[model samples]
Target chain A: MKYLLYCIFFSWGFSLFSQNKEVLYGLDETPQALLLNPGARISNSFHIGIPLISHLHFNGGSSGVSAYDIFQKSSVDINTRIINTISELDDRDFFTTTQQLEILNFGWKNKKEFYFSGGLYQEFDFVFYFPKDLAVLAWEGNANYIGKKFDLGEINTRGDLLMVYHLGATKRWNKKLTIGARAKIYSSLLSFSSTDNSGTFETRISESGNNIYEHLISNINLSLNTSGIASLNDLEGGSATNKILSRAFFSGNIGVGVDLGATYEINEKWTASASFIDLGAIFHTKDVESYAINGEYTLDGIELLFPPIGSGNSAPPYYDDLIDEIEESFSLDSIYNSYSQMRPLKAYASLKYNFGRPVGGDEGCDCLNTGENQKYNQSVGVQFFNMFRPKGPQFAATLFYYRKISDYLTFKTTYTADSYSYNNIGLGLVANIKILNFYIVANNLQWYSNFAKAKSVSLQMGLNIIIDENK
Target chain B: MKKNLYLLFLFTFIAFLFSACVKDTDFNQTDDIALTTVLELDFIFFNINSQNFTDLGINNTIVSDTTDLDFLDSEIVSENIIRADFYFRNTNSFPVSFLAQYQFLNDNNEIKYEVIVPVQAGNNIDPVITEFTEIIENNALVNFTMATKVVVNTIATSSLNNINGNLDLQSKATYYLRIEE
Candidate 1:
């Protein structure tokens, strides 16, 4: 049991944040850019990632209060701080996390000038929307909030653990346009989601009843679906670990998806690109469980209607009747049925203009470089990102500046505005020593002064081996 | 050599960022966390006519009725409740006064706590309404929680065989809870 708990805790700690690789976009030194937009032009003829270290990403953040708000040392009581924080948060606020690790990755450029890449990666994604009404109800109870309806619809959350195997091909279809598509196969290990609920609980003075007040639960429609969880309860520690590890392969619930991307060069200095990823659904069949409740019920206290004069009878079983009605109205049952869930789709687009002296001192383009116009050493661009979530689509915009500092070193800086914050500054570095490549990217640099106060953060780093055409 | 210098500078910056990134925070504040909640719930209610005071069509005084109410015996009520307030309102149209008793009994049928309410007489044309409140706290509150059942007794003060009136009773209980982590 202890081993299992440690494993679970480690896995959760390892799984951290969002899937947005904003810094890596359009970076041509390393092959990691291909993961963001497969059509992105690369300057290398071949690349192979160091297994399990090629791409490590962690991205997550809350749109509401940070941990410092509740844990900071202050004169006010901690409970007061918690209550104030809870009051400040709204239902639309959410916390989301995504983490991915590349296990195997390699690609080669063919004689036909086509780049083909394939790899497998494991990913974990989670999102939970803050339920303000529910939090108030639990903290203060209904005694003080008479007649106020607690909105149960605020409850919305989803999580998934899965592995993806993919292969993609990038083609410079013409001198002005490059297009690419990647096919993906997903193996889901575990999944759980409860969304789109509706209900209300209220207490009000009774209009006509034996009691002074009535308690009501009305218009309730809530459900939860999960896969690969119920069966784990019946297994022991080692068996459970084996089951999860085995499912990580292609033996678990399966799905398929495709990614499409394109880059266009309208003129010598103008460029635009776009990519759409994870547009597919997973079908959960084995070990599937679902629960649902829908109905309305009310309780206005038990009424003991006494018999009139000379009528020889006892009072009805009022308490029993109330219990029976409550049971009938809120009966929940587990259902075993297959279900399909669509992956959270993501989209990115950017427009950039290249300028500054070309590498090799404004000399003619490198004859051996077969990628995009290999003429610029510096560029500035604006990028837009949108990710579909359980609530709706979340958007972020960034303005970036990229520069090739030297033949072996590249640097990029960005300012971004997203739901979490408006003042997010990020930086990225890509370096190549002979055929060895390494890169590191991070955002929310200002929070490095006090990490606990930041609402969101992102970091990605990787190592790979590349072979240039000249080599 | 310039590339190596930049690489070295970046590595040192990253190490510095990690070494002193977060400010000091006291997570031990959780030890002082406590929550207080109040819940108001309806307990018992009833309505009776003059006929209930007559036996074999004969006028009878001091007639009584008893019913079982065991909600206060619940474990959650016993464990979390630090204080309780019982509110009662009675409307009587009977010519005779009345007495209402709430008897809280333990497992051995021993009365651990008892509450009595006295209602004044009223005429059939103008019903008299009366209210009563009982607040239990401290050691008395703990004793009240030990009750397994409650017996409510309604008694008449005089003959009501021919009294053409009704008596109505309504009551509610408010519990104050203290929870600590």
Candidate 2:
């Protein structure tokens, strides 16, 4: 049990990056870029992803403390290292992970120049903030500190596993502006959250009381809510897979959301785009379970009263009575309540300055070449991403240089600064072979030499078949 | 130009793959992990009025009470408790000094340990306060866990027919535990 606890603690505490895909944004050759910004221009007339192999992404890491900080070979004792690490880590430090797999994806452009795209994808996201007061209380207890209060509000965490089915359309309304919107239907498989807790536990010296030390549990309002978990047991057997597949296909607790995006051309030399995704909530009405504990209690030991002589009565069970009083004061209440959870909304915006010679030497007069179709061989841009979290919104800024090396290959490199690290470098590559398009993106290149020390890392890759209109 | 571009792309991809490498780390240090914690908790207390003793027969000089302490028998306390310090404060407002004897017994009602406190005498306007501290560790701590009950006896210095005061007792315990893998 001890090993398991430590293993889980250290594994989650190791280096990680948040769920922002900086490298995939603004790359014109890859169709996956449309997922980041629906208004993104694509020269292809139609495209089809190869089933589950279309797109895969994984990003996770902690903002503070890494495996090397404690497990690195050192002469100091491990216990001291652990203590020092705990002391240095604050409540604001958080661990987060986001994973996504594209099950089906395809898109097409109609005769009126409206680009329509849709897909179904599975995603899992989790985030847990460090509970500093609880860690200190568990490690040092209340013996050394006589009047310290452990804040229970520091315990904040949330996790969800769900499938999203989405469809979107993009069209150029005029010569200078393009706009798009995607409608989404979410099917949640499992979800749990424990947030907005408020409480404190403290021990103090009593000035005038029956006992010397007094213990107080004040203003406690803690709750945990879960959905689609209890029903998993009912889905036991070979049909469990089928049941889950069907639920993910749309039979589970469902909700609706939408993504809005736009691209604007200021002139022939500069372009700007912005997008907002996952602006929706999931209503968990089926198989929901919640528990709540609220109230305040104080104790000053068990008070014993001596019976009068020869009263013919045994001494009252003072200890048992105290236990009963405590149970009554701080009781756990099981609740069967339905609730709604908002998705983690994300916002992206970027500005690019296009220069250098246009691809294919701008020698042909083609209508499809008017927007984002390898018109410029080199460009410099800045991108900003923000995702709403339980604590607050997390933000990242990236400056990138995109180069179209040849007709069949292109690359983009980026330098990003966020809460995780200041020296994060990322790279993305897209290769075109006939009708087959392949792309890969990786982040945090500086720490690749010593990966264990890096606070965050992420990878994304995908493949698709596209047919260009000008072909 | 096309050949050079292909070669550059291939080289960049290989470099990206080869750049990720793990440095020196010793995960085996987890085997030596240990956590030491100390917890302060309220133990037992009481307030006895002198009338209870004065109501006794003219010759009676002592009164006793026994309470079951099931917490000492719990596995978590018995196994994790390495050392304990018990602090007791007694205030007496009676005319006569008293001897407070505490006897710890096992489940079968056998005495395992005993503690004696000498309480001072005082008047109603000025009560006497006496504090006692007991530390049990090593072999004594092992024997302490065997106790599941405590028998407290309050013995007056003499006949208690005219006593008119209160005896207040307050106590707490601090336990030191070392939990490791």
Candidate 3:
């Protein structure tokens, strides 16, 4: 847990370090090279670029669960021997449940072009499970013991995980177009449980010849149970020694995806680019478990020797077999098998334009005509992406503002928002100098009429080293 | 361009602040009304010699001449007359009614009898005795006498259980009182 937490925090911090000009101020609308900014790639050579990135996503929605009456009316024959030998207990009632989920995503990215950009993401979720109580009554083999009762059990389990990894490359076809592709692998783990035990019993007796002889008795027992499956115990325990085995089974699969991007220098101050990234499927291994309970009775001396004659003191021949049947019948492998069939896939596209003079140049723009010109540059962009397969299309526009406060100090601010329907907002800041690049970024700040709640905020600080190829 | 981006940033920041400050006045309001259905009962003890007995003018009045029966004292050789009675009412101002019954039995035994109680709708402020049966005597302890006492209050009615089979009873009987709408 601690290591996973560290990885998540580190990834978020790294994302802040690799802030793109478009993502910072909501100005860039097109995808650049996988690691380097669109403008930076034009200035730098084929020098390998490894950029660490992070993302925070959130989702909230309303859902409901329904219930059905699982009471099956059955005509059970009352055999004296069967009733006496195996106490006649009531059949267990059945109940169904439905639940809803509110989700949040926090992610980190480490990209090494031509190698891989593995990511660790934490998906926080809140699931609500509601079970309706069913009316049930059990027979205790006596006339005076008939009572009414219902189950009162509810399932409330929260917190889950969605982790992923990606590997791809960015290849420049020419100065006008850049193409890149990324393959992403991801998985989700969800689980929850609850149990309830409640009911009533009654007994009656008759008076005869100066003595109160026992007449009848009835016992009704009600029990409720619920539960959720989380990650294997290895992941639950934060021991470094158990990392190997835990990671082995915890790791799901690897999928392939490609990113194709092209940058057209439309003019001296305007550039446009577009890219399609991460189009693939990942599968998880199968694991399953189940739980259940049962009740029965034995013959009382009075019933064995009295009116219910011929009832002997021997265990019912089929009692064990019946319990075994129940155990095998409730196994959860079928449910898990169905869930394993679903896959995770995502795709996105962006368009952006930069309006500024090239660094250390005089012919680009009048704003940079002087060496001491301290005025800042500005850019704007928009992006559209599909999250969780084809669930919904997300649209966002960003504004980028940069100012040189001093020779060694610079300030930057970004504001971006998705479609008005979902209303997701993001803000970021960066302090860049010769020795270090420290920055902070926050995403999903408010709820749109279409969205549920705030997603996540990422803060990061790291050293920025610029290495000259000649050195 | 820088100034334009700054203006846009200012506009978005103000918009976000405005949205964040927007209060949700529409809310689902729920009154703290507990809708109860289950009425659990506990055992009722009738002390023969206790002076706390009061004639509420509801049940039969015990005249001064009537004999006092004490089943607890071994020296008193009187018939153990255990009578269990349930009172029903439609507490709601509107005529709320239900079909009620009393179930009596011994441990691991057959049910003795089912006594049904019919309730009328909108008949508030009335206590109707659903059961008034007397337990015959065999000198054996009545299961109710040895069990625990429990009082339950439901939305429709209130119930009292005199016999709790949780513990070993020297002479206790089990009785179930259930009401359904």
Candidate 4:
């Protein structure tokens, strides 16, 4: 039971988290916001992020169960509460975690209708599903049920540590249409994944024999894929910190991706926008390790008897016999090969209606509203986002209200419904002082009141230097 | 206006720190649920056909029957079986021991668990039952067969049908699950 329990953790070797940031998408208040939709119009002529402090994000969420499920001070015992929670959870329920740090970022409007931006950001992403049947058998002894096959396919998970270098350009034809595209190069530092395993393990009594019940592990075909991690994890493998750090950019194991977005203005108060990101894949062909088991074996409680040694006699291969029997019956193979994983493609679309002061109206040119200084005092919109997760596509729909309180201050709030939470409330604010700009956004504010009951939480903030040509 | 801008920046940063998702949650980590049930095998209809009880100069013959045991659990359990408790008795005066064994098999027709209960032969035909719990090596249970075979000690003189005997069994099952807060 202990060994199997250990395997469950080692078997979970993959991560169970996803990427879902609905509150910050299409906000247009922060330079980093453009990462979600490049076509978003910015009044600032140029901006430079303050290095490491430019953009920092941390978010994690769990669905199907929460902290309240296990840590709550209840009348029931801890184990009782746990089993009760497991009973309610299914395979579709998952846990998600994501963290991204921007190291270099800058954008400039070379012309009134054209703009350019680029940056380097290192990101760690992980997502995995809990294998319930495998967990139950590892914890409980296989005793009462003489014959039951526990599924091996329940083990499904994926995780990666990667760095991305990107450059983007936006073209604004008129006040009516703005389109942008971004190209990204991804370098994977370390990764491990083991999803889609198949097989079963069972126990039964011998119909005719001197032994008790026979234990059988049959038709086992499970595999674990890894990269970079295997060589570093090896104590004698010889890997230097400086050498590994140098490979962070332009590493042999690299992938290319792209992001495309467009914003179209239908009228003075109506607008529509959409963006697609990370549409590519990385192929792992170097420093990769794969372990697989593809065979079956059974044991009939055979007890080997060792007789006392007499003079002039040789020792028996007691342990050798067992090893030989098992080796002959089961096979474990380890190989190094190449594998490819698609980037978690993300997309967002929104429809908005702006109401407030119109641009250039004071100039008596009401016919032309397109300019570098079109300010809206208030706006409301609905946005939908989708990300390709390891399990499947995950979607989030948000309804938002935004306000420009002053010339240098703006605020936004959104109500969103996603896989994690339905009553997700988010708040974002952007403040401009002189040439220094700062913005901070947080989601699932209600969960802050009771951290233990919280299932999901997210926060993003950044600082940048901006120059508004219009001002 | 300058003071207000600073205040807004400070307030937003402070709010972000408070609602951040910082706590780490461990999944399926608790170990404390165990359940046990009985598997009763009543020899309701044991009729010896001519193939098993023929008097055609046959010195000895072995007769047996295998019945499928049902484990009605919804959630899939592991094969890391901690242990199994076996209890059964011989309630017949047939002299020879009644060999009973439980055969567990997976979908691939592979035998995972094969347990047998040996009833000792005494001078007096006794109705004695024995019980013992042994740790199982298998981690999962899919299906099993309860088989009974009789070894004849006497020379074959006549053929007879309807061999009767009663065997009872009870097993305790325990599994661990976790509840995270």
- Using lDDT as the measure, which candidate wins? 2
Top-scoring candidate (DockQ) = 2
Give each model's whole-structure lDDT. Answer: 0.80, 0.82, 0.30, 0.63
Q: Give the higher-DockQ candidate: 1 or 2.
A: 2
Q: How good is model 3 by TM-score?
A: 0.41
lDDT of 3 at A448: 28
Candidate 1 residue-wise lDDT at A168: 92
Q: How many residue-pair clashes does candidate 1 contain?
A: 4
- lDDT digits (tens) for residues A199-289 of candidate 2: 9999999866879888998989999998877766777676666666677867788989999888888887799999998999999998888
For model 3, how does the per-residue alpha-carbon lDDT over B1-181 read when each residue is reduced to its tens digit? Answer: 6545644554565455335421221111111111122222222211111111122122211211111112222221112222333332222222333343433333333334333444343322443322233343333334433322111111123211221111000112322322211
Give the better candidate number (1 or 4) by DockQ.
Answer: 1
Off by over 4 Å in 2: A1-16, A233-243, A309-313, A360-374, B4-8, B11-15
TM-score, model 1 to reference: 0.91
Candidate 1 on A305-415: residue-level lDDT in tens? 544324355445566677778989986878899999999999999999888765432366543232336557788999999989998888889999988777677888899
Q: List-wise, what DockQ does each model earn?
A: 0.47, 0.61, 0.03, 0.07
lDDT of 4 by residue, A1-471 (tens): 423433433222222223655666766657887788888776667889999989888777676666656655555765566567666777667766788899999999884657788999988887767666665554343554467777777787888888899999888867689889999999988888887688887767655332445567788889999887766764443455554566697774798999899888888688888999899888898889999878887765323222223335533443356557988876788889899888889999999888766544354533322235344567799999898876778888899988766556667889988887788888887777778888877777776665546567677888999887766
lDDT by residue for model 2 (B61-91), tens: 7777778888886887788888989888999
Worst 10 residues of 4 chain A by lDDT: A8-17
Error of 3 at B148 (Å): 14
Q: Give the C-alpha lDDT of model 3.
A: 0.30
Error of 4 at B12 (Å): 6.0
iRMS, candidate 4, in Å: value is 13.2
By summed lDDT, the worst window of 10 consecutive residues in model 3 chain A runs over A63-72
